[model samples]
Target: MVAGDRILMHLQGRSALVVGGTSGVGEATAERLVAEGCTVVITGRDVVKGRAAAQRIGAVFCRADVRDVDAMIAAVDTAADLGAMGVLVHCAGVGHAARTIGRDCAYSSAHSLDDFRETIDINLVGTFNAVRLAASAIARTDPDELGQRGAIVLTSSLAAMVGQTGQAAYAASKAGQLGLLLPLARDLSSKGIRVNAVVPGGMDTAIYGPEGPSEALRRAVSDAAIFPKRMGRPAEFASLVVELLRNDYINASAVELAAGTVQLPR
Candidate 1:
């Protein structure tokens, strides 16, 4: 909040819509956005968890599935009723585990075609749908006093650049997200919208399943040779997304948070 500090958001009384705001990095970013003075509308398919996060942050919960275009548009409609959606953050994505061959079968599993398609549909296409829907609404709004037209923050993964033994589906989807930044930024340029993606490393949050945080992922991570020797925190991811929310200087790019640990093809 200091003048010299890096946070650049002018979020007071503005509105932001965070997709997949029920948990993990999504929930963390929603909290940070709220704290930065943006009235937040958080969405997810899990009504219970979504409502909980919204209530906890003093925001509203909108039921939405990013993979469904209608639902994504509905989320924007809900934002319209609230206020100008000055920021849009898409954090809904699936982290998958699949291998093409059996080289790592002892520590891997093959994905069915259904699983592969679902991963692609939800992770890549879902992100694109959310951005299109939200950016359309944001483009209609007048610029802020700062002549800014809002930012779209997409979430990618380090796996997009360097996949491990069993991350074919996940890596492909995340890499697709990385690939969309340039085109999306160009397409939305005339509208004054900025598009960016965050390629965060593994973070410590409960985004795995209904089972809560995964000890198995933690074990695998420890067993593996990560440079930092530990998982990243959700707050760290949120911090970067918050910076992206108000930054006009950062556009058409993806930021990585891997701590130089993801060079190998593992």
Candidate 2:
């Protein structure tokens, strides 16, 4: 490989599949990958959003929910068909606000067991489902000079480390991603695939959808930020992901993209 090609712009001629690519961080990452000359396939359950994002970023759209085993496998297949499945960025996740223990009321009551399980199922299990299926396909690819077959970027949240009042399920789910990283990386080492997780703090994303945070809650979250005094940008998250993919040395670690925010205890 040429000197420049070895270091910078390693994503050129690569192939990537981004789950949850219909919006937010996934969409931004897909766009960045496309700009880097990577063939990209994006998957999401929202067909309209997925197709729009795919068209916007010059990528193919596969409607797959991360929780669906067969559907996720198919999405991986769609990406692997492009080339070797060089990168799998899993940005699909869901979050809700419910305290584990609270006052006796419908909405204010303690977190339900069913809610916790659903969160775990969608966020943690869903992530692993995609990772396992994608890693299998990626493992089949011929390794590069460095014996690197591919890289996997899993999305975690800062709440995994320090959670807020109502973040029991979300934090547990995201923390599970971090927990899986080391073992998954070690297990896939023989296959020349690298696994890493990104822990992001508050970000300007539609993960909350229309019923997002109230003005008071938003201020509280933003005020906790240390430097720059604002929530993270999706592009910023994407840039870090691209960097991790280019640098083969970064593996099995959870990189925090929190901007030094020290969240106050609830």
Alpha-carbon lDDT, every model: 0.82, 0.87
Off by over 4 Å in 1: 1-9, 102-110, 209-228, 263-266
Candidate 1 lDDT by residue in tens digits, 142-251: 87545567888999988888887778899999999989999999998887788888888767776666675578776555444357776778888899998876775888
TM match of model 1 to true structure:
0.88
lDDT of 2 by residue, 24-56 (tens): 999999999999889999999989988998999
Give the winner by lDDT.
2
Off by over 4 Å in 2: 1-9, 105-109, 211-214
Q: Per-residue lDDT for 139 in model 1?
A: 90
| Candidate No. with top TM-score | 2
lDDT of 2 at 69: 91
Model 1: lDDT to the true structure: 0.82
TM-score of 2: 0.93
